[model samples]
Structure formats: structure tokens, C-alpha cells
Target: MWKHFKFDPNSVNFSCFTDEKFNKFDNLLRFEWEHAVSQDLFMFTIDYNAKQRILDDGDLNYIIGLNRDRQEKRRVPYLFEHVNIPFDNKKFHFNKIKDAEVLFSLDNEQQTDKHLIIINAAPIRPYHVLLVPYRELEQPQVIERNNLISIIFPDVANPMCLDSLCDLLLGQIIETKYVVTADCIVFGCEFVAASAHPYIVAGLNSLCAYASVNHLHLHGMYCPGRMFIQTLKCSVFHTKSNCYLLDSFQPQAFAFEVKHIDEFNKISQDVYKITNYLMLNNIAHNVAIVKGDSFSSADNVLRIFIWFRQSITNGEKFERCNFAFLELSGFMTMPDEKVYNTLTESEMCQHMNRLGLSVEEQERIKDDVKNLLDN
Candidate 1:
């Protein structure tokens, strides 16, 4: 029943996961993943077969690529258009997982503090894995903000912890060979069971997202190229909070920043309140927590970008392209060569716009967010 969960002596020591330790663990993870792939444990070798290019779309320039091989190999049970799926216990979940897929387990002082680092059998990018916090808990796909942050990023309320988490993620961007993105996605499960019908999927592939497995996990993927969202400029949305709106970017999004540790509580509350409203309203959305563009060892600023978009339902005759967190964040992985080769900035913008709400609808959501925070 425990699968292959075993404490890794070299794994992160939660009591003190310094920047140096993070570097060591990253190397260890890559080594373990490569070893597993060599042994033919995974479904296929993780390769970047896509032809990539950077488009100069004025301020919203982005990295676009096509991975036709992954498109053929990866499992996509339902398209992004299928949003009203139920949480069926009969389906696969992290609670029941293959032993060989596990990288290792994180067991610190107590056995109950263990977490599983499992390889994504089918990955969108290299070095992809699910960071399952307390695998034994059998938590559902729902995102409980406080519980999630506490377990994955314990003591984040503390400035030191916040900086450490930022360094852990940013270190990947700087030291790793490939671009990386850390997305804690909530696809089909809403904060409340009553409002779950309008849930969203995070990744383009169903296995990577789309409630393929109803398990609480954070996706850590080393993408093929850098994403534009890391450096995209934004205008001030609300004069009161640290939130800023990504103006002029298709599928408008709101971003929150934490330049100083003292701003943690307020920013956390703001993110929670906004996401809570979106979930309750069944508004499909994506949350990306990454190191800020201005990040440095000296000034490690953290950023959180939230995008509330329209759910492409089954019956709707909408634009067919899937726009999840990665696509919205400006690093789209196309399903085929034609789409990748021909998707221009203007057309990409149109597709993104089609997947999102109108300006008026977004304004109303912003007002609702403001009201929630004010109360």
C-alpha cells in the first residue's frame, strides 16, 4: 500500500532547506529521472521535439513551440471543453499509484511528515513531477489555500520561509538547463462541492490536468523555453492592494507581488479572496506562483498571477485551442506543427480572447474581488 515511498537521505530537509540544499536536490532529481527513463520505467523518453521560436509581439512577446510527438503519446481523455466532469472515485488517483514512478519520499523528523515526489509518466516537459504533500492524507483535487500553503510551504508567513520558497523556485530558472514553471492548478474541483461544475483544467494534456487523477498535487515542470509572463509589464489595477492587472495582454489577468516579507499576509489574503470568488462562481481559472522578473538573491520578489477564463463546454462551438495556465502565461505548447507554425500574435490573441470573458465581465469580477477583500 505504501508503494515505493522511502526516505531519501539526500532529499530536502524541511527543517533547513537552504538554497544550497535546493541545488543539490535539483541535481539529484534530474539524475534519478534520467536513470528511471534509461531503465524504461516511464512510458516514453522525455524529449523536446518541438521547434521553438520567440515572437516579437510588442510588449506581449512569447515562446511558442510544437511537440507533435507528445501530442501523439500523451493521454487526453477529454478536451479543455469538458468542464462539468464529476469526481469519480473509480478513476485513478495518487492514493493508488505505481511504485516505479516515484522518485523518492520526503520524510523528515516524523513519518507522518512524508511527501511523495512522483514522476509524471507522461510529461509536457522534461523533469516533470507531482509534488504530493502528505501522500497518505488522500486529499482530493480541491485547493484549500491555507492547508496547501501550510503543508507545501510551511511557515511561509515567516519572511525567511517566503524567501526560501522563492529561492527554491527561482533557483530552478537560473541554474537548471531548461525553463521551468511552478503551477499549483485547480482544474475540476472547486473550493465547495456545490460549485464544482464550472471547474477548469490546468494543462493542455488531460493526464497532466483535467482531473485525470483526483489528487492534490503541485506541478513542477522544466519547460523547453522561457515564458513571457515572468517579465510582462502590468498596470495598477487597484490602488489599494499589491494586485496589478496585465493590461493589453489577451485574456487579461491579475498579478500579486510580495517584494517584502511583511506583505505576505495581505497578499495571501488577497489571492485567497479573489480565487475563492472565482471558485464559488464556477469561473475556470489558473494560478501561477513564480519568482518575479526583478528577482535576485538580494531582492527575491515573489509573484502570483491569476487568470479567470471562460470554460469551453462540450456543446459550445467555440475556438478549439486549449488555453490553460501555460498558454495564458505566454509559453504555449501547440498540439501540431501547423498550429505552431501559423499561430501569429494577432490570431493567438484572438484565441486567448475567445477563451476569456469580456472586459465588462472581468470588471465585475474585479469589483467582486474588491468587495470580498474590503469585508
Candidate 2:
């Protein structure tokens, strides 16, 4: 599936510090980083000092620690791992099935509101729930304005809504006495499955997870996927022995495994940052950040997946067609690479500008995103 879309690994400039015949893990990471750099999809200046430290330690603990220090002092955005257990006997209580139905009914009723329904998802992860306006929105528009604002200006209203949803979901879980452990809040404009208004999940939280439902929503728990689980079982790195795992079966269709919960948290933070950057730069419509695994097993042949949204084509009766692809891995294929590569950044910018995102709008979105994460 990916063979048709495979890109030349040599397209990017990357230098690894090992002569010891590239191993499977090394190859996968190198391929991903190189591909990203080549396409100018992401850029970063690595600290030589930190690089030396990591090489000397030959482990992730010291490296991640150094990275954390850099983030605090230099404000460099990077991805890391995080893990959380959703069950708490004292903080949560089970309800009756009738209560669950009632809670669902209430959510259904709330769907009439604009802001509340836009989020389409609820958070069952304690105090967090996803919220959005009820109107149908484009992905870029949501990120540019709605998501950006929610993240940047996480004021009373945002948190209050999240709390309200959480309270409601908990009520439902209790009603069924379903031994619910955790929940996740997924907020999006169109759910792949629901393909309607945004929605939310109230069950188990899995990291690196993907859902077929398209309604805007959010997940409230941190659950790792099969790939992440496999990676952790073989990893030796530890920091406070806390691990954060994410598993995604879409895009590059892979999973992520990291040693610390903080790292995973960092990834979420980075996602916000990336979204903010796009909106601020007047480049929202044609942008995507997808992560997953490309390998069928954990045998050192994995692929680090990343996808960037390219263009929208009007096929048949105005049905929206989005162009996107996985990097480095030849697993999933697409037919639009040449056209994407031919487009200049300015041309891309113009296209986004046409989508109603202006410079001021971008700034607003950036501010909103910052607020969402800070709070």
C-alpha cells in the first residue's frame, strides 16, 4: 500500500553518529527525521552538548532530562512520552444503567448549542472534557479558530464545559456499573465514523488511538496501543519509571513508545504548538500532523509515521477530497506527491488565505491554543 507513495530516504540531510551498521530502530528513526527535514515539514537545531550527553549515556533517561531542561529554558517544542492510569477507587463511583441513559439523553439535548456541540466529544478523564461549537466546520477552520482559542484561552467557560461533560459521563458509567476505568475526549469537526456533528468517547482511553467516528470529540484517558505496548516491553530506559504510550492505526499507521509520561504530554503540547504555528502563518487548510507505526511487528523494521495535509480536491458532487501521505514508510501510498512537491510555500499560503484565515485570525488562534495548553 505504501510502495506507490514511498519517498527516497536520501531526499533529506541527516547524519547519524554510528558506524555500527544501522540497526532496525536506528534506521526507522533516521528515516522519519530525514524525511521530515527534507520536505521542510519540521525543523530543529539539536544541541551538540545534549547530543554528546545522550551518546555518552547510551540511554533515553539522560537525553530526555536534557530535553526537558531545554524546553524550560529555551522553549524548544519537542515530543515526549507520558502515561496515566485512569482508575481511581476513591475519586470515581459507578452509577445505575438508568443514570447512564439519562446522562446520554442530556448530552443529546445539549447538542443544540453551538459552542458545546462543536466539540462533539466528552472527556471522562477526571476533570477534562472536549467541547466545540455545534456548527459543521472544516478541520483547518476548527484548528485555526476554535481549537486554537480553546487551548490558548482556557478560561472558566472551557474548563467548566469540560467539567460538566466529565460529570455527565461519570454519571453514565455509574448507571451501568460497567467497571469503567478511564475515558478520552476527542474533539473534531467530522468524525470518520459519525461523519456528522462532533462527538466524544466515554470508555477506555488508548494512546496512539484512532476512531472511525468523525464528530468533534476528545478522549479523557491515556492508553497505549499494541505497538507502544510492544516497544515498552523491550525498552530499558526509565525516568521515575513513568511511561506514556500512544498508538495510532492511521496515517503512517504505527504506534509510539516512550519511557516517561511527561514525553507523551510533550507530544500533546507540540501538537498544539504545530496547530498554532500553522494558523499564525496563514497556513491552516493544508496542514496535518499524523503519527503512527508502519511495521507489522516490533522486529526493528518499524517506520516512524508523519503526515502533512496537502490540498483539497472537489471530486464528484462537491465531496471534499483531502490529499495527505505518510513519510519514510512505503506502506501506505498516495497519488499526489508530485503535485504537492511542485507547490511553493507562497502558493500554499495563498490557498490557505482563500479559506478565510487571515494574519490576525492566525494570531487569535495561536493565542487560543496557548491558553488551552497553559491551563
Candidate 3:
């Protein structure tokens, strides 16, 4: 017999993820079918305040019936390992992570002792994996990301270096052929996104980062709905002659892309350099990595978008702040159907205005790093 889960939502450490016993494809197919017949996913709807939810078809009027009593609105939760967020305002006992099976583990071909990927049991999407640093996972501390790197690599002893970590993340990009709703994963703030089978990955630097649970993690899912992989349909953002990547710039939204090894190396190096800069200033940022497909190569092009934001130390957090990586990528997810139904255009503008970087602000950060992000 299958075991029953004992949940303690108030404990702050209880898990919100699960590895479904049913086949993932079948489950998804079933969800799609239900939308075909009834026009809703279990009556849950999401309001992407800033953007319209991508309509599966023009006829998809999947809102629940008017007579149906409104189901208690609930936002899907991130499968994080932690006690309550900044709610308690004091150290809380660690919530012992459950020993559940993950849909996938690390790629056996290139598996390493340094880090391992655990397909989230209660995942936001299929093959949704979390890269857990071993030493840190085993010993759980509010330590810097580099501390885990130094222990794993042994060569980079500096506490601030993020290269090893970056390399590991890059390797993750190489391993998987798919990423999902990065598009669908949005919580209250519509921060999550998952589309069709396209490579989408993002990372949160520390617990102080916005994700619900405060463990260092990289989020990757396949999303095909992303309209703009490269900023404004332009592949390369060059400063003057298209010889070198512009330090920081995007025509519509601030974004950049990398096509070859030399460009990727320079991009990754620029990442660590900027990360160190943010750390010095005690700021936080979100990262999104995009690829055409698993078979994509340097010639096919890969993109990694970084944008600055406030960290927990700076007293910045979205109580219900949504829109993490995928949302930042232009696709957004709203987990509550009722809210999605109710969210008006004006409210959407309000949310968009209050949160995220303004074009002017994006330009400022881009220009600020114009030299730094270029390496």
C-alpha cells in the first residue's frame, strides 16, 4: 500500500512537492483533455497581471461555471526545503526533508561527487530538477555558494569565486534536452513559466533570494512559448561594430545572447564578475538560460539573461511577489484560476508597474554594467 503524507503547513518546513505515482505524460494529457471538455485545470486559474495567458486555442473558455461556488483560492507552492519564510522573523527548526523518489536523478553519464540533481518530487513540471550541492545538502548551512564550490572542486579556494558553480550550471544546460513552464511554475506573483519543449533554466543565489524555500538551487524546465529568445529578435547586441557584445543593452527588454565558445566563455566570466560585484553591494539577481533544443550547439546559440534586484539583506521580498525567471523571460504563469479570471487590465498594469525593472531602470543597470558584463 502507498504511504500517506502527513503535512504541517504551519511548521514552515513541510514540503509542497510530490513525485506523482501516475505517469507524467498521462497526467498532462488528462489535464489537457479536461481543459478541452471543461475548460479549466481543476478549477484553478492564474492571473498573469501584466500579460495575457497564452490561449491554448481561441475557443478555450475554460473558466469554471458561474454557479459553481468559488473554490478557496490557493497558489501552487515551490518545492523548497525550509521552515516558514521571513514570516517568523527568527530561526526555526529545520524541516527534515522527506525521502521520496525523484522522477529523475543526476545524468549518470556525467554525474559527479561535487553536485547532484534531484528531480523535484513535487515538481512544477516534468523533469523539473534541482541541483543540490552535496556537502551543503549533507550539512545544511547558510553558507556562501563558493564555500560549497571550494569543497567540491578543491582548486578554487576563494570564498567568492562562482566559476565552479557556473561551470556546473552550464553542464546542466548541456545535459537536458527539455525545460518546461519555467512558464507554468508561477505562484501568486506569476513568477513561474513553462511552455513547450525548449530549454529554460534559472537560479537563485541564496536563501535570501525570492524563492519560497531558501536553498541554493537552479531551476530548469522546457518552455516553447517564449516569443523572444534573443532580445527584440536580434541575436547579438554589439556595442559599436558588432565585434564585441554590448556591455548591457536590449532594444525592447534588456537581454543578450551567446553563440560560440569564445562568446560563452566571455559571457560566463562576465557573470561571475558581475555576481561578485552584486555581492559586494549586497544585491540579488535572477538568471535565466535558454537553448534552442538539446541538440543545440554553439552555432545554434544559447542565451543567459541576468537582471538585478534586491536581496533579503536589503529588505526586499515579494510577500506575494511572483514572476521569477520565466516571467522575466516574457512568459508568465498565474496559478490561481479565480484570480486569473478576476485580474483586470488596470490591475495588471499596477502589478507590472510596482514590480520588476522599468525600462529606464533596466537601461540604468545595463549601462551600469555596460563595461562589467562584457568582461
Best by TM-score: 1
Comparing 1 and 2 by TM-score, which wins? 1
Model with the higher TM-score, candidate 2 or 3: 3
- Kindly report which residue pairs in candidate 1 clash with one another: none
Candidate with best lDDT: 1
CA displacement after TM-score superposition, residue 24 of candidate 2 (Å): 35
Off by over 4 Å in 1: 1-22, 57-59, 78-86, 105-115, 146-212, 260-266, 294-299, 314-320
Q: Which ten-residue region of model 2 has the weakest summed lDDT?
A: 189-198
For each candidate, the alpha-carbon lDDT, in order, equals: 0.54, 0.24, 0.37
Give one digit per residue, the lDDT tens place, for model 2 in 81-192.
1111122233211221111111111121234323331111121111122333332341212232223211121223343577786665555442222221101112221111
Candidate 3, RMSD to the unseen true structure:
14.1
Q: Give the per-residue lDDT digits (tens) of candidate 1, residues 1-375.
A: 222332333331211112332244455567777766876866666664547877665546677876555556765533333332344566666767666667764432344335566787777666666667555656554444543221232233444676777886555443323211121222111110111111111222222223345556655554444456655567777757756887665467788766643454456567667765766676766666544343222343455677777764442333335666767766777667777777677777777777668879888988887777667
